[model samples]
Target: MHLKLIYSKKELYFLKSVFLSKVEHGGASQLCYAKHCKDVLDFSASLNPYPPDISWIPDMKLLLEYPDDSYYNLKKAIANTFGCPPEAVCVGNGSIEVIRTYFYATIEKNDFVRIDPHTFGEYSLSVQLAGGRCTVLDDVDSRVRIICNPNNPTGSILSSSELIEIARSLEESGKLLFIDEAFIDLADERQSMINKGISNVFVSRSLTKSFAVPGLRIGFGVGNPELIEKMEVIRPPWSVNAFAEDFAIKALENLDLLEKSCELIKKEKIWLYEQFERIGINYVPSAANYILLNIGADASLFSKKMLDKNIFVRDCTSFGLPRSIRVAVRTREENLILVEALEKCFQ
Candidate 1:
């Protein structure tokens, strides 16, 4: 005989509804294309088309051994890069893991988490998963505020002074602020709040986009030592794998390669913008590696048309921008192919 298990109504609802909801994201080439489509070019995800040279492989001995539970070496490397104390760094599997950790560390049940409407979806999803409420930035009563610098999809950015003032205001009001600077390396690093030593603010940085190592999944958070310590408590041990830790350490030592990649991205961004102008495609000016195009109707059909040619772009309907599509700056050759494909779609 089978024994019946029991769950509370609230628990059952969460399991059936919240947990079952599908999560959408960009850079899903495997999902968007067939297994054998080796020629598929992805412009949906924002990543440095030219990644830093990581030719050397990790030591075989390290692969056999478990990663450091505290991720001490990785944190030290990130601290040095950002010019902050190691105590102020908290490494994670990715920026998304750090984001969820922040929510778990700070939010109590039913607490309010404020975010800009068009920012990353993870901010809202994380808050909801933690049993917290999500509010818009215009709302005055949130317990926490989260912003994505050089925001996703739109690629809009807030100035350093503007971010500082927002942090100060939130601090004065006894609220927490989280600034996601995942794309800041591709933008202006000088405008980053990572080295600001702001007590009430936490800056989340990703190695995935800028380093072009999304598969390795490395990210970190910088904040006051006390807050970092609190996040560390809730973060799982060995959350960052051995390979990722080694990769990040090596990547940090070679800053020149990252700089070169960003330079290429900036140049290609200009070319892409000019192509959009020539094609009479409406787009938002971007500070990061991606631009948002206003396609004048649902972007699904346009995206499908491009995908048919082995080119993929992000459909921004889920971001509440129904008529917009966000495309990342690719290599000159690749961008030209996309332009020609888009011309056909437009015609």
Candidate 2:
């Protein structure tokens, strides 16, 4: 009698199906892929319009050597800027990578994770990828809760105090809370919960949004030493390239740049809000560097119409708001052009 034969990880087939599920993120990738990058005004990415100046050219000599797996200096830089010990920092290729590491470290197969709706899709996707189930509602049995602070798409935020309380509540029940503060540097760092020293709470941040260097892909997590150590052990060595490490250290040294960017973004966001009101475009007031608009029409069509004018905005269907679009707060010149394009669309 023949026994059942073992095969490759058949589980990956389900993972593949999960990957095939629809999820869209806005950036210049589409325009670049289509060879229309230069003339296109991209409002899809929510980033600091003005990034602090720094020498981005990496020393070729450094590239000749392998990056330090420990990234001691880089951790020191992050620790100084974020009020965490170097041992409390877990670095990743991007904040998303850090999210994946965290889930892998804590999530068990079939574990239920509580996730908010209409936020960054990555939270749900990452949990599912880690053999966990994601639920939009809070279930008594759920062990983890994910939140995108200064939330994407909606741009809603919870105060540091509000979130600290939630973290404590979860901690008492032997649960964990993960906050994605990727936008906090561009929103209000004073509202960040990174300094709370909550053992069961994890906060992930990225230079992608605040430093406007998505290509560099430097992101990190802050947590108690025990949790950070687990994630660090699971995170692959040399995951951060030489150039990204250098750039991230430089960006941390110039934290004041965030203040300047926030000031300018606030001014521009207000101007955009006024324009939206005057033009009869309904919009949600945002606490971050982006605005959510209610277009009263199919967002995909509105976005395509705007694209015809060489402007790009985020179609909200992927975010589960089919009648809305999200626009990034940009410079005065670009904002004017965007308003002009909108007027033409309405006409």
Candidate 1 local lDDT, 120-215, one digit each (tens):
888888888777888885656888999899898788899999999999988998988899999988888878998785788999998888878789
Tens-digit per-residue lDDT, 172-200, candidate 2: 99999999999988888888888787889
Cα lDDT over the full model 1: 0.86
- What are the TM-scores, per candidate, against the unseen true structure? 0.94, 0.94
Runs in model 1 deviating more than 4 A are 1-20, 32-36
The C-alpha RMSD in Å for every predicted model, in order, reads 1.9, 2.6
Error of 1 at 213 (Å): 1.3
